[model samples]
Target: MPASSHHYRRTVLLLWLAAAVLLGLTWWHVFALVSQSRAKELANAERDLANLTRVSQEHANRTFRGADQVIRFIQSRYLELGNTLDLKALTLQGVIDAEIFPQVGVIDAMGIYTLSNQPITGKLDLSDREHFKVHVTSTSDALFVSQPVLGRATGKWSIQLTRRINRPNGDFAGVVVVSVDPGYFTRFYKELRLGQRGMMALYGLDGVARALNVGSREEFGRQANNSPVFARIAAGEEEGHYTARSVVDNVDQMVHFRKLPGYSLMIAAGLDTQSVLGNHNAAKEALWLQAAIVSMLVLALATALTRHLRQIGTEMNTRQRAQRQIEERNAQLNAIFDLSPDGFVSFDNKKRVNYISPAFRQMTGMGNETLEGVDENDFSIWLAWRCATSTPFLGVAALRADLAGGKPDPRVLIELNQRGKRVLQLGLRSSKSSSVSQILYLRDVTHEAEVDQMKSEFLATAAHELRTPMASILGYAEVLLNEEFNAATQHEFLNTIYVQSKLMANILNELLDLARIEARRDRDFRYTRVDLQMLVTDLAHTYPVPAGRSGLELTLPEQPLYLMADSGKLRQTLLNVISNAFKYSPHGDPVELKAWIKSTPNRAPGVCIEITDHGIGMSPAQLARVGERFYRADTSGKIPGTGLGMSIVKEIVALHHGTIEIDSAPGLGTTVRLCLPTYATLQDSVDQDGPSRSKLDHAIQDTRPAALS
Candidate 1:
């Protein structure tokens, strides 16, 4: 082989060896992690199974113990009744007369049905019943439970409990049986759950599942004397697990079984294996996906490495023959670096600055001749400058590091004041060559900050000035209305003053409210349970008097409603709406106040208060801009008021955690609707403290609203 081909073969071999080693290491690490994770999951599953088994056994014991106690209590009562048979019959007769007989009927030791307080009367054969049969056959005086059977007298599905009795000669004489309606068992297991897709059933001594198995009644009377579960129980096992197909859904399930304490019955709770192992199946799928990805990545990386080695081999073979070409290429690269707009530098492993272009010094505000001997690691001067100027250079360093790790980050815009009042934006990058150096380009952005500052200062001054006079005017009007004055002389003047004052106040408040909201300050919330009906009635009474004075009618509902909300805020919202109605409508136009609860689909219950006025209503275009601060519908200035009532209403409603909607027509009428949540109690209305009084209101002139004359 030629010398070049020999070197090429050696390079290929090294690449292959490295790829193989890396692939094996990666596979081992991933496999070990997956295996350890799966083992922990399996252990946790086994522990959960053990806990479930213990819980099921305890539940079964409690149920059986309760049943046993009920049987014993009935047996003792029956024995006592036997001694006073006459009195027992009298009480049974009285119960039947009263038409509230007991659910169960008791029998005496003589096998005679002494008391049948139930409405269904019949002489029944005690020997034929399973409860009586179990009692008579047993040698001991133990409580015996029988298989579920149809009662011959009532024809209802029932289970029976019985007590054995003996005659004076010590020979078995008869039995006392207490019939239990199977409905009791149905109710007992109705709420019991094994899992999302699991159910429970009770099994008897005869291997037959009982009525407790919900919705499997057809198989009740069928013989089940040879089930695997019953066979194990008969072998004296207290508990076991069996894989069986459920009769209800015909799905295979793992049934956990427990024998009831001192009872022949057993509880079988089943969980579908597919359902129980859902999360495990999901995890396994994820692992398989990861393994496939790992294999593909390994193949891709190996191919890339092979290609890279081939390229390096080609370069090495031509190195001796192209010495002049390599020098020329290096000169061209140096020229490009020096002429570039951004800072550029190359550092060797020892952290010494190997190469830096003029652009680097220019961008960093450094002298060009002094950079060559400087250590790149000693960058504290640059960091300190960044901190002093509040320039975002530390973030630039982090951004460059992230870019090196194959992350896509945006060019950062930094504000820097380096030796002048100029701001700079830096664009940083790490070379793809895997060399230990970073590149950066920076520019200025001082004009943007000046523009933003102008906007903030304008809003603050304008809002403060407008609000001061508005509060003074509104507050004085309120004081005049509240004081006892000469009614005939000053009423009209005061009313006019109040109306104009309200309009001015609303404009000022909206401007201030919007300004504060834009500043993102904390909102004030007050909770109070207001009788919604009372509020509506008061508003209606006020609206009609004003409307009547202007030759108009006001309509309202005749009932009371209640809701939880900030009353002051709600009043402000209402005042704006009522003011709007009076302002836009022609004198004598009817206004309607309606309050009702709206039941919204897929939303919380809402209480709505609506004000409607019939006058020269607004166009759709005007209504759309109604909530904009200082937004005027009619610029003709014929309307003698500031156009901020609706806007203030919108803000106040928002502060009260309510929503407002407007409906209007050019020639018909306008309606405003406010929906708020109904407070269930006083606690629901307010936060931990009661309604908070506004400190801002105290600082400003008190703008108390005047009551309607």
Candidate 2:
């Protein structure tokens, strides 16, 4: 009986030891996982802060750079035109972005506020201002960024960006000052949606804040020399991040900062530590709860080991089921990866390709190639070869080197010369799983790139078109301001200014009209039955026939050709077509305007208005791009036209459920056919498909105007 008791005591002792060991190991695992998760969370927050800092730095740089450009331009103009620079006219002409720099002025050598975009009520002395004093003391051509101060001219808080104006003889003439609104930066930061406790700031290297936002509170001109960032900057670091207590609010934050290139300013973004780690704390709590439950289970198992040794079998079965569930979950994840539109690739811990999703294979056009087990170097080379030859992957070596150093840019853009031209945004990230060390994601961004490119081109074209007339107006006005002339000469100059002003107004009006039409489509149109014959006759009678050009030869069908359209818009379209006809033709060339009823198979009956012009006809290439905005065949600048008339005409015609066809050849006459749905046919369509459907069909059909040579 004693021996039995000893053995039982030994068994219990052994069970207790096993339970203690299990509990200890389980808790260790939980702590380790929690620590790792905390580190990852902090790391991700730092990365996000870094990205935001970079963006903010870029924004600040652009703002300062643009301000510098404006200052330099004004400085040059002030020196060239002296006091006759006319800042008000420049502002009106959009040479100055008035909304951004509300007060742009010139302070003369004697400290007098000589000129400004804003009206100067009386002589204002600006010599005592830091921006003015700095330029007055030094002849440095570098742009000076000053601390936030109340502008005497603007009557508001602004940052003064100044440049020295030098005369032709190298004398300091004055300072050109541009007042930038500090609220601009803060307004943009608000859009970033940083956490409630987040912060974004712009500080000069000299330790003064240009603009700073902490939570919802904003401060300017606050000294920050005591901040840790200055110490790092003193150590020659251009950019860095760290976790520290804020000097302003005493809140601990994960802060990332970047120094704006070619400027003395730096931008910093911070995420509140508490806010960033809130989720991590929650996860840790759940893990600890799980650990507690596991410990209780271990103790219970130790206590019941003798009576329920069979419980071990049940535990094994449960583990098996759990393993099966894990496998099924993995399969589901695999299916999701397969069906995802974005491409993904995983690299094993050894930096060799382990798996590539089907989408990745198809995206890279390497579906047939065996890529598994390929090392990073070989994979980079293969990928580089697939990229466009014109823009070869020159960064492959650098990217590989960065990866080897365990740091790489998070994102890159690669253009591929594959099935068709494609632009893919590639993102790299570390994987959490033990088997996979890294993950690469690829997303198609061709459409976005194209859109950005088109927008840039449109802005550039519009600017160029507007600048020409502006230059003329500014030049003539400057002449009038700077020099005295005879009555005839003055009248000629005034007339030139008037003509250029009219041209600018015309361009602006047309641009607004085009924008309105594109945005609202036909929603703003007041539709009604309109007489096409009457519209044509009225247009020809009131049309301003250019010098050496005859009136339009108008013809109409016996029956009044009617259209279900906006009469005003229809009249504008006809006028634009007729104007273009006269503008492009030779002397005495008659613009033939003919109207008749027309019908095509499988289409509604319509009225066709044909306008024929016989001089300087376009080539097939030019004709193909006739309706494109700002596309003028006459690049020699001899022609006086905005090149938007045809575009407007096409838009108006399409809105009226019509089609435009252009037939032309180089050195030959051109015929433009505008076919509009007749009132009856439109009424029938409205009865059958509803007005909206009919409009949709018309829009789809008229998306591209037909051109023939």
Candidate 3:
């Protein structure tokens, strides 16, 4: 060998010896440090285990006491409401009100079960549970707490506590059970400060751990029970931490298990042995790192891990608190809107409905049909329903106006048809501050409008009736008392005075009859079977035509008009029209009376009366204003008359279920047509009370007549 090679070999040998010696010393020191650390860890773990055991026992005791208290409370409630608990007579709502927990229920021995706020009421059997059997058989007053199990009704995991109740005869009176979720208990575990790679688990007597961190719960339960520490706890012998092979990673782990008091359950906590003997691990890594820079970063790794753990904890607490606040606010808002008086609706940014208040459903008469996730235009069900019940309420218009216009300051009104007789009014207003909702208000104003119109008509009829008769009586009395006439003239004057007095009397009688009819409000027409042709003939003969009249013609149809009607009102209506024409134009032109029966297309048969006269016809303006009470047109400068003629005629025609129409022009003749519904019986009139005839009558009654002369 070369001298250089021989020298390098010696050097290598010495370096190898130094390296081996340093590694051995480092290993021994780290071993000693780890032994001390382990001894201290065991002492600390024992103390922690004892504390945990005491805490767990206290927790279990408190929970047991709480459950017992709940049972006592339930027993008191049951006794207090014993009369209400009769299985055969209990109502669903009553039971719901009587329930102690909003999320739980009770089943009596009679098989009657009561769930809180539920709409179901009936008998139910609960003899199928193992826990119930235990509860019934146990001689102690202590509650029998069942292991965590899945609920059949809600499919949720829960732990049940059952206690038997005794009757007056010392017989079993069924059991009161309280169920709580294990997850609720799991929330307490989050406060445990386990080191890196540390974990805790809870296992039931069924050999199933309800929860685990990284491994399958089933596998953990199966293998963990076989572990030395778990075995010690199962036998009720373990008191402190001990080293064992981990069920998941096959590495050594320091573990502790505590048995739950008076229950077939256990809680286990475990930490990785590598993490527990951290000094030894650090020393082993340090030697290797002296030769490699990668291992030298161990200290930095520990620092980073600590920081990350703290950050994660802080974030979790923040998120949990925020979630709680959000839940509380949401609940409060729901209560406010649900009980609000106005109809309320909320929409999302996409214009999809999100919420609707109870008032909305009550006002619009909607049920169960979801408005959420539906396009505003697709809400035709509400639209059609609103149109049927009240005025149609138009929805908020467009997104551009709602979003870009600063707010949802929108208003709309819609008219609705109700049964083809009444129209309703609905008003909708969108919130000015919120773009997400709109409010609707519906009002039934039909009766209000009727009342207003009746008031106006009553005042008008009273004034006209009172003034017309008083004016005629005063005028005729003045002419008679003044004696402004000779023998021949006096005769004419006296005759004129007599006619005026009779007209006055007729006006007063019409007013009195109208008032009586209104006070009775009886629509029942006293029908009498009579010869219709004779009635028409007598009416025509009763017409007071002037002597030496100007070719006045009276024409009637050559047929017997046999009909059932309120003959008195019908006769009054006919006479009012005939007398009006004569009083307006007695000498200017001949009067013509025509009668016929005609049935137009899609109409019932009715008698038609037309009275026309070639007289001083009224101008359109004068005719338009004539129907108004005491309203005399300016064209009739010297006319002596009461304006009640047309008004009375309109009222009489309406009561008889007939219609009146007038046609006239300036310097032309005037024609008045009246169509009286000729029903065959009183029943026919009652059934035909549809607005078709009333609408026609209303229009005719609103029409103006010629100015009096």
Preferred candidate (TM-score higher): 1 or 2? 2
Q: Mind giving the per-residue lDDT tens digits that candidate 2 earns over 1-709?
A: 6999999999999988988877777778678767876886787788788778877877787788778878888887676568878889889989899989999998898889999999888889988988888887787878889999987876888998988888778899888989999888888887777878898999999999898888888888889889999899878899999989988788998999888878888898988999999978997898787678667777876654333334433653574476445321000000001123899878888888898999888788886899899987788888888898775664434544566675433467889988898888787766557899887788877777776787889889989999999999999999999999999999999999989988887787788788888877888887765767778888888888887667889777555555667788888888888777777775567789888777666656777889999878888888889899999887887778888888899888877768899998876778999987753443333444334455535633422222211
What are the per-model C-alpha RMSD values against the true structure?
42.3, 32.3, 43.6
Worst 10-residue lDDT window, candidate 3 = 328-337
Against the true structure, candidate 3 reaches a TM-score of 0.34
Evaluate residue 644 in candidate 3 and report its C-alpha lDDT on the 0 to 100 scale: 60
Pick the winner on lDDT between candidates 1 and 3.
1
Output the lDDT of residue 313, model 2: 37
Across residues 519-552, which tens digit of lDDT does each residue of candidate 3 receive? 4432644544334557667876666676766544
Candidate 3 residue spans exceeding 4 A from truth: 1-438, 446-450, 453-461, 464-508, 517-524, 529-533, 546-552, 599-604, 618-637, 654-657, 677-709
Give the best candidate by TM-score. Answer: 2
RMSD of candidate 3 to true structure, Å? 43.6
| Model 3 CA lDDT for position 272 | 66
lDDT of 1: 0.57
